[model samples]
Target: MNHTRDKESILQLYNKVLPKLAERIYQNLTEVTPLFDDFRLEKIVDTWTKDRNASTDKEISIENGNVQQLGLKLSLIGFQAAGAQTFDLSKDLLFSLDYSYYEVGPDKNSRWMEKPYFEEWTSKELDDIAVKWSEEVIDEITQKLQGL
Candidate 1:
């Protein structure tokens, strides 16, 4: 296998491969994100009146993606005690994960750029999902590039 030739092929693969992979990852993440039904809704609102439902939703997206990099954003609204009333930890939260990829021999590799900015503010399930996403990116990319 010629090194330069392999490089060119990998470059070509990026345009064809990354966008599809990104879409799948985005969908996988959004499907499992929480709606905050488990949160303490009773304490947050004036429960003395009627049923105060603590509604929440996630704003998830594949922010950017190309040959060398991919970025993802996850924002939670109405998931906390404050229920979007303020920007503090007791309210809403947001974070981003970035992955960079490269070719090594006939395989591709990916890694997250850094720990999420609001990692400590998030739940264990969310942390696990983020880790899974990073691992899935490298595994899937490697499988796709194995033939090249």
Candidate 2:
């Protein structure tokens, strides 16, 4: 019922739990980075303070990277081979000869790729970590409040 106590409890939750949750999420995201050829995505993933109900707010943020673009392309139509082309040449005549040639197209092996690391990891995994950390913080606070 005390406003000051309520504020302190919220601060304790933010200060003790959010950082650990963010760190765990960041680590899980980084683990999936090796699946990508470009490592920049791993480097750009970070946790920062945001202005949410005061300066005590914290959040995990990822900067846009080329990996996202590549993932989209792969997801839509698979990987296209660079510099691939198909050619054909033919002639028709009495007692004549004909020839034809074509280059193989790009590999359509989309299976080699996966959904964007950020998307897959953040969908439910991050939330689960946050919930676990939150429960830990709440239990700790309750114990202290009850002098257990």
Candidate 3:
């Protein structure tokens, strides 16, 4: 009978709950994901070095979500060898999580259910995300190598 009152109640509910929902989403995205870990960077570096005749003792240090090459160099046929180059490979590794709110119109009101549902991501999906991030790191390394 009172449409304005119903909309006010919905807005009030969204205002009360959205911040916590956003925080939980951010924590779940960043804390559990291995995207910024050293192991991930090592995997990327390993993949890159696997094709090249690079040394086995490639060292990497990730501090505060920043990937720092301890002492790595590339000596390709055309490019001269640059000794002990430290690359800030974290540029591509930087990530942020975002969430948005949408108001359903009368025509689209039936599209979603009354309750919101969240499904835990499968291992395969997580692996796929990791692969994407690995590619980003590889691209950054390749660009740095080209500049040398």
Candidate 4:
């Protein structure tokens, strides 16, 4: 439990899966509203902080057990408009993701877009970000639990 996972590997995982995640959510939101989902690598960014802990369970004595916890916050930079909002007529159409994470006692969050207006993003966008973080990032962490 003493090796660190390279940041490059983590970034690769994020890039490969983020857009796919977006597409999955987008397809599900094909109804009513003309709004649709499209994956944007340009304005999208994901940041992850790794906290590694090494300890054994007190309840059940284990020789040596270690756990690595990862906190990922995904953000989106886009544009959107409110009021009689027409995507076609909107003057501004940019917004970011609402990402909040907490581990033990520490809490980290993504930047909130509170300018011209918060982008009224489709549920798919939010859902996709969450899924990618949990799937691509969390899964790998669980597989290799070691201190970084």
Candidate 5:
């Protein structure tokens, strides 16, 4: 088994695999994400309104009965090294996420970059986990989507 060959295969898997993953994760989240119902929505509005710490007031938007401006962004990066003559090739993957949460601060309003999810994972470990999660979720959602 050539390790260099394996690295290429895995990289190809992600390159080829991720478009499907993104589509699935997005569609699944959209379908599963629920708007706060009139009852639950009050809780959400209360949560936002309780946010009195405002150096700057910001207008909020609602969409499909849910907060439209709920914020977060995610990214994944990958790298690989061909194995030495004596070793199998290796790969390193990073799963990076950026997002802010609604939290009150000194002035009662603040949102900041929460720690990236992959802090628990090193660069190599993160890629591996991200790929695995993507693959598993994709398969699971595909079946679920088919039913829907």
Candidate 6:
């Protein structure tokens, strides 16, 4: 089997399909921006890019004309703070508005205070968009491979 053709196909798939997937994800994120309180999440969504972090390199490879080990890393700032809120009581102290005792702050009193905006967006919304886009790309590549 001539692996060169397979390699070429994989490269084509990466070049053509990956950006579309990224764009779709970006669009989905943009649509859900109103659900988040933090402006940083909106900033990250607006700046989403398919640079080095979103490429398939050595860690990902093409095998027998089939795209294998393909992966994408969506690099964003403050991604760690996206899920749940964690405070270190040993190193940090929680003070109330009057600075008397430990009490829930004003921000925590909000309905959306339980989970970070980015966390909800990534886990629920982004996951669905990514899966749908991935399946579309895979199906397209499969069709192309069949032709080859």
**Reference-based lDDT, each prediction:** 0.30, 0.27, 0.30, 0.29, 0.28, 0.31
Q: What is the C-alpha RMSD of each candidate to the true structure, in Å?
A: 20.8, 27.6, 20.6, 18.0, 21.0, 22.8
Q: How close is candidate 6 to the true structure, as a TM-score?
A: 0.30
- TM agreement with the true structure for every prediction: 0.26, 0.23, 0.30, 0.27, 0.22, 0.30
lDDT of 1 by residue, 24-123 (tens): 4445545323433332211011112211231323222122111222223233333332323222112111111123223211112333223422222234
Which consecutive 10 residues in model 4 have the weakest lDDT in total? 60-69
* Candidate 6 clash pair list: none
Model 5 spans > 4 angstroms off = 1-54, 58-121, 145-148
Instruction: Report how far residue 50 has shifted in candidate 4, in Å.
Output: 14
**Which ranges in model 6 have alpha carbons more than 4 Å from their true place?**
1-5, 31-67, 79-148
Q: Model 1 residue 100 lDDT?
A: 24
lDDT of 2 by residue, 30-83 (tens): 433333333221111113423233433223222211111110001111212234
**Model 3: per-residue Cα lDDT over 14-112, one tens digit each:** 343333333333343353233322322111111221213234444321211112111112111222234624434332221111012222111222211
Pairs that collide in candidate 5 are: 53-107, 53-108, 53-109, 93-127
TM-score of 4: 0.27
lDDT tens digits by residue: candidate 4, 1-148:
2222333322332344334544543343233123312222221322222222324333211111111222223222221323322222111111221122212111233332221112233555456444443343333333333321
Candidate 1 ranges with C-alpha deviation above 4 Å: 5-7, 32-131, 134-148
- On the 0 to 100 scale, the lDDT of residue 67 in model 4 is 15
Q: What 10-residue stretch in candidate 2 is worst by lDDT?
A: 93-102
